[model samples]
Target: MNYVSKMLGAPDISVTLARAAARRVYGHSNRTNPRAVPTSHRYRVEEVPPALPRALFDTHFAPLTERLPSVTYEMQRYLRRAASLRLAELISGGTWRQCATALAIPENSARQTLNVLGRAFAPDSLWPIFENVVDHIAQELDESDARVDYVKRRRLMAQWHLPADHHYAMCQDLRKLRTLREQSNPSPIEVLVWSAVTEAEYLHSPILRALRLSAEGGGRSLTLSIHRLVRPTSPVGGSLRLRPTD
Candidate 1:
């Protein structure tokens, strides 16, 4: 009654014989049993395997689908920031002017605060791509007066020492100095000292006032200069000279 029984032309087919026949037909084995063959020589219908459950299907695919979009978005953002930094470095290093003429921007206009910022924050891991973005910003600034002027104004104000009323400006400049200090290759102390001086000049706060007071008080007076300390004279001709004890 079963497919295997019909194939063997027998009233019943042994499970072992059916399994062996299936294996041979599927190419797992080459040898066949001649005695097990049926004279009818016709194939019978085989039962289809049961389908996998929905829960198992979801378990296998859900995680991959959930993570794919997040991974793609992060990679795209990383690439963009990387490219921006690369272009910035090129412009900051003074190479942008040469290339700007072809792009119809004045050399002066090509320099912008954004390009400087890009160069300053160039991503260490993605330096090359970021440099390209800096270059693009430079090129764009070259062609547009509005962008160039805005960048120039920002840079000028960034470095300018506005009076203490502009506490915000001083804060911005100090923040930039701190950022630069972290990135500079020089000794950290030296960078810090420079930053302090820059901050003092820009902010004119109590710290700078104290520093000025200390410098002015360091023994410089409005009278004839007098040596406050004495040193023993070096021995000459084997005789040490002594000051007269008047």
Candidate 2:
């Protein structure tokens, strides 16, 4: 089972159908088998915070019986508060320091923070923390070039390798740049940051990489995971196994 499914107590999927479905849905990928299940109108259900609707399991019923027997930690570090707490507990020693490190919070506040997290009844408060934690993990992942906010023009210019005299030209071009930014529909800041941070080559910083992963499926992954954790057990079984593609 994948980390998301395992964490949610979702049953394993059928390998053949999962593979065929992924290929059909996403086209063939040489790197690995495609594994993301689509959230089409056929699978759509009314979703509220912290509940995995029965429709999800019912709709995807055909391919979830057999086990896929593997897990991924890359996305595990990016789970919701409760799942993250569960993960922290599962880590070696399960110390406050360990939990602190995992949650990207200060060691002193680790125990208190976890206590609060453990008892948090509402999902609203936890989401922001998840974003902040992921950014911290991204910063931690990249050890060599320290990550810092490049919000200022001087810093942005240095990052973008722009000549001092080009500031006015670039500012003027912002109007024309609107069309380019519209292609991806990225935020103004995102476009500005991307242009500055990634000069010629797309050398994404750790935070940007984390942001990209977090933005997958329009932030549906985290929401799904949250819903999964809220209702962790399911008796339903089916016949397909799925794994994430590169």
Candidate 3:
């Protein structure tokens, strides 16, 4: 300090500071100190926020939910709200998990998500199909002379991934009421056989059959369905078993 005071007249000043002043006088102090933090550290690392895939959102998630616009729109709003909440939760910095958590969506759980999506993406409600079948099926068949169109039914059901099995079975029971009324001579106790022999022909079986492949493959493959806009039907035929191709 005494030597620096004598040299630069700045008593008790650091040698580096004294040198810095000398360099500044000649415009040479603009260079950073080697011992100091690097320029990289001065600039914070900025991360791009996680984005929901547009293709997946448009094709798989969006189109499937078109049938239930109100429900799906509400859900999307909730998810977006969840994402906003997660952003609020970030204290220091955000991570990928934080990003995913914000949207109330999981990451790297493809199989589970796809399975749920398969069920959630159902365009037609199985219960309604059953109800329709029960109410108008007899009339459509007997009075209206309309047979259960298996091709059209399969096409309709193929659009969904999951079939409401319990509900479909219940609808079958409702249909059997017609048969029960027509027994030739009612036995004291006759075993009521509710189409156990034709389990494949249930109302929702065709859709479940096609979607089994989708459910098994998880998120990798999407179900391929051909649909006609005909009114709902009392579906015929059994579970279709086919492998999705490459």
Regions of candidate 3 where Cα sits further than 4 Å from its true position: 1-49, 53-64, 69-74, 77-108, 123-246
Q: Rank by TM-score, highest first.
A: 2, 1, 3
TM-score of each: 0.19, 0.20, 0.15
Note the Cα lDDT for every prediction shown.
0.29, 0.30, 0.27
For 1-246, candidate 2 gives per-residue lDDT tens digits of: 243333322235543344333222221111212222322211111111111112322232122111212212322211232233322332222433454443343444434434443233123333234323433432332342433322232234443332334433443544423333343233223323443332211112223335456646343332333223222344121101101100
On the 0 to 100 scale, the lDDT of residue 136 in model 1 is 43
| Rank order (by lDDT, best first) | 2, 1, 3
Predicted candidate 1 versus true structure: per-residue lDDT over 1-246, tens digit per residue: 245334643436663464444322221112221122222211110100011112322343233224333433223322332222223323332233432332222344334422432333333222223333334444543454432222233233334343433433333534533343344322122322222332211112222323346746422321101111111244332112211110
Report the alpha-carbon TM-score of model 3 versus the true structure: 0.15
Query: How many Å off is the CA of 49 in candidate 2?
Result: 21
Please report the candidate that would top lDDT against the real structure.
2
Error of 1 at 65 (Å): 24
Q: What is the lDDT of residue 110 in candidate 1?
A: 33
Worst 10 residues of 3 by lDDT: 237-246
Give per-residue CA lDDT, model 3, range 24-79, as digits (tens): 22111222111111122111111211222222234333332455545443354332
Query: Cα miss at 213, model 1 (Å)?
Result: 11
